[model samples]
Target: MLSRTIIRSPGRTFSTSTAMLNRCIIYTQNGDPAQVIRAITYPKLPSPPPNTVNLKFLLSPINPADVNTIEGVYPSKPSPTSNIAASGLGSQDKPVFVGGNEGLAQVVEVGEGVKGLKKDDWVVMDRPQLGTWSTSRNVPFHGVIKLPATGLTEAHGATMTVNPTTAYNMLDGFVKLQEGDWVIQNGANSAVGQLVIQIAKNRGLSTINFVRSRDDMGPLVDHLKSLGATKILTYDDLNDKSLRGKIKEWTGGKDIRLALNCVGGEPTTAISKLLGQDAHLVSYGAMSKKPLSLPTSLHIFKNLTSHGFWQTNWSKTHSRTQKEELIAKLADMMKENKIRAPEHTIVNISAQESDEEATAKIRDVFAKLAEGKFGKKVLLKLEDTAT
Candidate 1:
């Protein structure tokens, strides 16, 4: 939970000014990731305290990490709040922390003490957690950022949190690659994978991307090549005895210094085996749901270093200026068509659906995602007038 402290400022005490109104998604008991889609009524919001702001969500994406939270596996937990004046069905009940990590919104109202924001301005939360899935939110002014006017769509803005940032930071965070240094990553068709390819291309770095060997491998490879990936391979290549030799031949036996792994287990070991001496392997995800197993040979002979990354943890250490600058650069790339938003399959969750039905639907999607059947990103659209 985030620590709260009171700041001394002369003003009227903040209090609820309007009738309580909010429709939110919640999960009290967690088992399967899909079992978590219960809805609850929100209490009326109080008028913003001097330095607070109220925002209406325009859009938000449902990423894999969000699904992990539902499965009760994520490191962060939503903080529960009390319901004081609930009005909808089950309103006379306990409080629940809203679930979701990011969104794009518009400022509808601001407190008297607010100076940098106003009504109708587009903005996004800098630290969205456990509540962005709702129609509206009251956040501290410091947590809000004014969106750039560079034609960034609501969908793009909604997705501004995880995938794009991961792509940017992962490539830029590790060792500096020259114009032709080769970078490799599994899950090459993933949202982050695609972005990595494009960003690397823009920076003049080469990429060798790996995806599963499916019937559609040809088209997937072509698509990545179109995004400037220099080489594409599949999981089958991992077991091919001649694969490392092929990579050596492809790069004229030049040393490859960096590898990105989202898939763990044997795939991670394969990547490590392919790295040059003193190379870096950055693991940002455990998509395989399996522990990462390393080979003793690579550690003793290859002189490779393994590092783990979590975007939420990274955000804590990064300065505000660094965060904003990275976003601004990504926005520029999008405006110039140097980078593209991930393809998404939006699933609408309505206020009308029964609890059982909604939970089943979310669960089914999670199952498919776990099986690696979804060809694109998954998003849950909350049916709200503000959305």
Candidate 2:
């Protein structure tokens, strides 16, 4: 096996002789992100393992799942890395966990046995929980998927694996939907939910999108309509008996075959009731922090099915070819202006920013996220081309 070296220090890329210190957000234990997450620096890496490739972070989105993982409440957890010792990075005794699950990066160096990849190629993690919130790191190449630099924006590619894939799979995986078919989902304004609305519209399928009721839901409604949503309803509307009559009238007797549930509780019950018969409901998240409560009569009389989906686990059984095909199709749609990245606010954690500056900026972003201050997704741009 063989390898190469490329070092990225703050403000500039450096030669092998001068190692770059790596800045990362890490947590040793689970708790509120503000109290638990810390910023640390690791010395420049040594040569990569034969099958490993060095990646310079391009952009990473701060997903809710990532925060839940840090809070020790997520199903997927970041594996601990022993490479960073107490002697390096931090003053603590044992190694800690790096944060973030999804991101896009550039291949800076490849070990000898690595094939079909080279310096300067863009890639995204094929799997999750391998940290991507840092400036650079060496990772096993099989866990990453390559991307053409021109097709998709850094934000689109960076956020692809989780929310987009979840949307694509939820639409395709559960049922054999035909043109004019209807699907319903709560949390329909979420990134995945918006993608579902667009993809369904693209394929001649219609969606009944449900979001939480607010004083004024005009913006989200107008936005989803632009993305081709067939029907948008509030939680309060879902609770009303007349809503079903309206949905039926809109669909013109077309069957509602699938219900996507991310927010549980009554919203889940409401959508479940809309399914005609033998329809499937896929649950991916519980942003409302409530248990899914479905009436037993639906299962007995209507023959409804309830399932949970996790994109990270699905990747393990799929082929690289299959994954790339979906990515390319979505990117092509984006290129044609048929679909777009979710609304997002960029949080800069540039390599040039000092430790104090970087940490403060990161903390501020998390604070906003914790406060639910941003209606759009928050993306972390750390490298030159990330914007």
Candidate 3:
């Protein structure tokens, strides 16, 4: 049985059994997250098997895809596990599916034959749908890639797997762009979009960014520009027939060979229209939830090509060596401060809180995200509340 007693001291209060207990947010069925998901305290993980290391997740992010996954909407799904055997009041008999797909973890215990990793080493998941929302678990050595020893924060490590990786891959995968080349992308204010802007700039590529009109558009525009966007425009500006001519002038009549799309609908069509001959447009997301519509002329006459990109698939297809190299390169960029971490807020889940309390807190965060209340990206600090 796990102890839930809270011990207090002059300047500290913590669960007496903190080190002995492991906690995870889980669901047996896919549905509304708040309704289906709940927290469970399990036994601290046993020593890992050969080639595996016990991990203590430090921080996890609450991305939109995570929420959709809880609701059974996302295509990728996490398998239910009996490994997390909760005790006492919140114990479960059936297998439970853990919630979360990205996180930063520290190796607490390493099994026999594990090489090059030691205690307290920071690492990030290399694959998707690994159920990252936990205090601890044992993972195979190949399932994680060790992060650089310094120059990264909990938020950066937790988030480096998804949006940033997406942005990095999108820019490099679909198009072979040269320095001074121009790229265009919609959803310029998105996390991935901001990264694309910065990374493209770092590569000496210029980006024409488009975003939705908002009441506080000025500050948002400034933020994107500060991240190295060459030009920022709203979706409304796409209605102008003269925008293409202006883009051409801005690019000095050079071909805009690459375009990134996250927002579908007509915004996608509008950006596709700006690409020069033999250009590639890559779509990773569709925030508008609308189909991508394009004229046949662009494909037939201009030899324009369209491709879809998903970072999860990319990670799975790539080798561990490739993943390590990519992560190391990005870590250096973080160290140099070339690519700044996104604006974010941390949601702390303390060991002191009961399963119900922790679940409610997480559900509230999701509710806020659904209603567009959280102004910044949310990172989950799911370890001991006191620490």
Candidate 4:
């Protein structure tokens, strides 16, 4: 139960007598994020229920998927809750849904029957859409995984559960790649793509990275190359008929057996054509907003196979022990500096700021994201500055 003293106002009732406040971004209905999303400060959460723990968020990433979810375009959906009503957070006609899919949090309070978790332990969400964009909340123990005791920064922990895990799985789950083998992919500048380049390099595999032409192509190419990309090409480069021949020369005529596709449509098909017989083509995203249309000959004559991967589905089917094991392996790589955190900017939300000011700051960030203005990742630091 929450330790609060109820107070009645002219038209509504709210809680008081608490020094600490819990604030989160929320929306009553799905729509344009700029218009629908707002921040609300509610009473601090009460003590947790059985097998649950109160988590104080350290940092959370504002991923594109989070924006899509709030717009009701993403497949994953967060549940609506009235838990914050007593403090008068949202409309009484409808429960509000909190926004965020990924975050790193520390356990501040643990409930009965909990094992292997206590106050001050760092953890990440085990599943998706649990409303991670908050100062703190109570989550079931099973909903979070205690991060490994590795020398990982808050940035690494905050972003690890999604992009890195996706890259790691897409490489290992789809095809059996060996040393000296080659991989091809588009969207190579994305967070997941950068990780793929480094992770593949760590396993002695080579990658052919492709990205859209940009004004600052030189620096971008240098960055990807630094991450172990064998070759970086713009989509426009694919128009060259000799490009395939040149790729053959680069890999010493070796069969390009694996292809990772995030951008669908032409680019995806173009990469698929480069794969050898019996190779696997994995599709994890379609950034182009177009359908993938491949020549039937590639599937029939070349014996190529196609598959799709979603980390959420994988987590839903796998055991907690299995998930922890994979995370540990990734952390080991992080310890060795084989895979590093992606380029990102931290957007801090201070407790001292008024609710309107905080809301404007977040919406501004989202507006920039919607306009493709933020070239790097955005991480949220919802700090309790007043404390």
Candidate 5:
């Protein structure tokens, strides 16, 4: 608790009578992160602006896109800055960008004019490019999005925005799919792919899932099937020349109208060959680090449209109310236990760690992520999020 409670509601600022230090993953230059990323601390925060709030980090995910953005390859990049807030960040010789794009945080202090959020209330960085890999931040009221703290665990709330919403929109936004309509997706065990299986199951849509062959492939396949995948196939199955004919016989000439491809290269090409006429092939990722190759025949004769989907872009174009409705819908399913959290590895970033230790931990995690080790989502859970 603060020594004195400063309640400034509409046209006032909170007095800087209290001190809060913020620790963040900061990158002043984009390159090999092993050489650049650092941990910086903000000694104290001044009074919040009339339209802003102070938030302490709860849990932030380490996503592939976040890594790429740090490497300076991703399209949606966070702003490099030395002056995003008065949190003592500008002392650096050069401007820097924080790591993380998605995470859950809790409000600790609010500007008098801030509405809908209060001390101890949970919030997620609903909007894009807001650097989230930090212990705390002073964010504009409009830039922060709040979620109920009880329904979602740190993992659920931290991750709820991007992948689930992406899968939800791709399924419901592009096509008018009926109960029996079929959808096929590569990377079936990916965070988004798993969500697709559950959401599709809930909507009565049949899902055909494909994953890379692994030693534990059978168990993975079973797990997905339990999540409601109608069928699971491996990349090897896609290569089987008899696959299309087999699908034709099994599906009884059913139209597989949509395909989600995160693994590109041959896998994308092979899946495109199975779509019905005028099907939509949405590419959201290229885990294989290869370009998408669609058969000319599939496009020319079947009239398939190859497209891209970015959840960030979608958020920009749609209304916040619409996004809230979708979040509420997802929440209902979560409350019903229809949405299960994915397996993940948590790295604790507390207020006590030194810069070297934090940097080493970050490098270690990134190495694993780069090597694709530990088939689980990596999350940095903060130990100082309490209001």
Candidate 6:
């Protein structure tokens, strides 16, 4: 069972207070990873707009995009808000802005005009701008998706926003794949890739997954296969021409209709070469940080389609109803054991913690991630009571 706790502001220890308090992580100037994040405490919350709900965050996953935002490369920028109340020495001014894009929250209070949600409802919002890294948020009710209560833990709910949604949208959006249709993707062991394999299996699609050689490839391959991957290959196999023949045989010589590339460069080119004519290749990330180069023959003769996908763009253009439908489907799949949450390591950024401690912890994690040493997703568990 998962441990649960209510977080309150440190000031609560000094006196009996009724005001809602929130603690947030912010970055003002972007440069090195260490200089970016600072922990700020707020004494009170701003009055919610009409038809809005105030939410207490339960969990927020720290994603690569969050790191990119701190480095000032990401497109979305946090805007200043006066909603945060005064804290101690820096209490008079609102904090720069809290830093997370995706999280799972519970509605603790609703504005008078808000209708669809009430206290104690599980919800998620696209308040990436307001920041999900904080202990609480005030967002329009329409922006929130109410999740089913039973069998879902706060960690699963919090981590649901990015990876799972990205996986679902990528698989469902680009192709018209049918049962037994073969799809190929790199980064098979990644959180998104794992979800893709599970979703594909649920839809009866076949998958050809690729991963880098690692000490735990056995466990990773077993995990993907358990999720219904048809075959698993490593980057080393892409260099061997014979593997292409093996892929062809496994795919029954049927054209691989979709190729999902998270790692670019030669690996991407290899996947492109394997695609049958009129196949689609979608690039959602560049983990390798190398530019993708494709030969002219594949483009000219194969009639292949190459697309770049950003989940942020998809979220903006898609309707709430459509997004909710996808979430509902995923939740049902979880209930039926068709999908499972990705493995993750949790870092609790409790409101009462010291800034140095939080900063040091985050910095170390970022370093590990940059070094490719961290294997699972890192999540920040926020607390909200008086905090």
Q: Which candidate achieves the best lDDT against the true structure?
A: 4
Q: Clash pairs of candidate 5?
A: 8-112, 9-112, 9-113, 10-112
Write down the lDDT that model 6 would get: 0.78
- Lowest summed lDDT across 10 adjacent residues in model 1 is found at 8-17
lDDT of 6 by residue, 1-387 (tens): 223444443221111224545677776567656566776666556657789987777788888888888888898776665565544333335335567888888776788888878777778775456588887778888878898866676667877778888988888898888888998999888888998999999999898899999877778777778888889988888889698789888888899989998999888998889899898999999999999998888879988889999888898898888888988887788767788876788888655566667677777777788888877888887554343
Compose the digit string of candidate 1's lDDT tens values, residues 1-387.
222233222321112223335556665555665555565555545667789887767567777667767677788776664432343332325545566887777776899789779876667667747377765678888786776754676677778767788888888888888887889899888788888999999999888888888886778877899899998888888899988888998878889998999888888788778899888899888778789988877878988789998888888898988887877887778767788767878777665665456557766877888788887776666543211
The order by descending lDDT is 4, 3, 2, 5, 6, 1
lDDT of each: 0.74, 0.81, 0.85, 0.86, 0.80, 0.78
In model 3, what lDDT does residue 104 have? 92
Candidate ranking under TM-score, highest first, comes to 3, 4, 2, 5, 6, 1
Comparing 2 and 6 by TM-score, which wins?
2
The candidate with the higher lDDT, 3 or 4, is 4
lDDT of 4 at 91: 55
For each candidate, give its TM-score against the true structure.
0.84, 0.89, 0.92, 0.92, 0.89, 0.89
Better candidate number, 2 or 3, judged by TM-score: 3
Model 4 bad stretches (over 4 Å):
1-18, 86-92, 385-387
Which candidate, 2 or 6, has the higher lDDT? Answer: 2
lDDT of 3 by residue, 1-387 (tens): 444575453332333334467788888788888678888777767889999998888888888999899999898888777676565332355767888899999887899999989877889998677888888878788889999776787778898989888999888887788999998999888999999999999999999999899888889888898999999999999999899889889999999989899989988998898899999989999999999998999999999999999888888798889888889888888878888988999888886898789989988877788789998998887764332
| Tens digit per residue, CA lDDT, model 5, 1-387 | 635455453322232334445678888778977667777665555667899987777789988788888899988978765644434555555576878899887787899888888887778776677778887777887887777546566678788888888999999987889987889999999999999999999999888898988887778877998899998998889878898887777667988889998889998898888899889999999989899877788878898998899998999898878888888888678767788877888899765676678778888778777777868998886543223
What shift in Å separates residue 134 of candidate 3 from its native position after superposition? 0.9
lDDT of 2 by residue, 1-387 (tens): 223366663333433323356667778889988777766666666777899998878788999888899899887877887665434643345558888899988787898799889877778887778887877778998878887656567777788788878999999998999888988999988889999999999999988888888887888789999999988988888657787788789988877989999998877987898898889999998888899999999999999999999888788778889998877777777766677887888887665666667767777778878998988898876532111
Better of 1 and 6 by lDDT: 6
Candidate 5 lowest-lDDT run of ten: 9-18
Per-residue error for 213 in candidate 1, Å, reads 0.7
